[model samples]
Target: MSLGEAFRTAVYKEPVMVWSLMIYGVGISYAAFVKPSMIEPHSKDLPSAPPSLKEVMAGIQAKLNNK
Candidate 1:
């Protein structure tokens, strides 16, 4: 069979494989073409660390007192 016929048969037999390959291709294309700046965060400021357990308990206690 010709290349096109073989490809069609493979697609019919393994649809999931074909779909995975298509998705991988799209992802690769996007990464290759898109600028790094577009993908990365624009802000230079880093996120603050999570609140400590003590801080969390204090907030919970404050809420209980308010209620």
Candidate 2:
């Protein structure tokens, strides 16, 4: 049988299956259509950029000196 038929059969056999399916569908729909800005704070600070080459070199030098 197809996936739809199997899902219908499961739902019919167990009423609780409907609740789980409804939650799953709602979660998927929200994630699919909702904007990220709407879900989270737009004013939140962005992440810092990665270390520069000079910073990385200094870190390596410090490690070598410590060793």
Candidate 3:
């Protein structure tokens, strides 16, 4: 069988595999290209350090108190 026909048959028989491969390809493409471009403009906006446990707990406590 021609390669095209073989590929079509394989895809038809294993649709889930084909779909998963397509999703994986898209994810890799996004990570390699789209994600970097998206993140670059916002890099400065990101916090340099994570919040401390005390800060997080205080925020949570404030929220609870407000409710």
Candidate 4:
């Protein structure tokens, strides 16, 4: 079944599943909006130029393999 159908089944057929999903959703929403992430505010902390192709390729590979 699709994600939507699975979610609907969880909500309608399983009250515990719905509560668990709601808790998970609230946690995710809180993290996305309420959390303060680390980021450099100064330009000096960043690179002066764009990254090289090697860095780009490595990043892509790492992301695809969940490294």
For all candidates in order, the CA lDDT equals 0.86, 0.83, 0.95, 0.84
12-37: candidate 3 lDDT, tens digit per residue: 99898899999999999999999899
| Number of the top-ranking candidate, with lDDT as the measure | 3
**lDDT score, residue 53, model 1?**
100
Write out the backbone clash pairs for model 2: none
Give the lDDT of residue 46 in candidate 1. 56
lDDT of 1 by residue, 30-52 (tens): 88877566656754465567789
Q: What lDDT is obtained when candidate 3 is compared to the true structure?
A: 0.95
Candidate 3 Cα outliers beyond 4 Å, as residue runs: 1-6, 45-67
Q: Candidate 1: list runs displaced more than 4 Å.
A: 35-67
Residue lDDT tens for model 4, 1-67 = 9999997888889999888978999999877866645333565687899999999999999999994
Candidate 1 worst ten-residue window by lDDT: 39-48
Best model number under TM-score: 3
Better of 1 and 2 by TM-score: 1
Q: For every model in order, what is the number of clashing pairs?
A: 0, 0, 0, 0
Could you arrange the candidates by lDDT from highest to lowest?
Answer: 3, 1, 4, 2
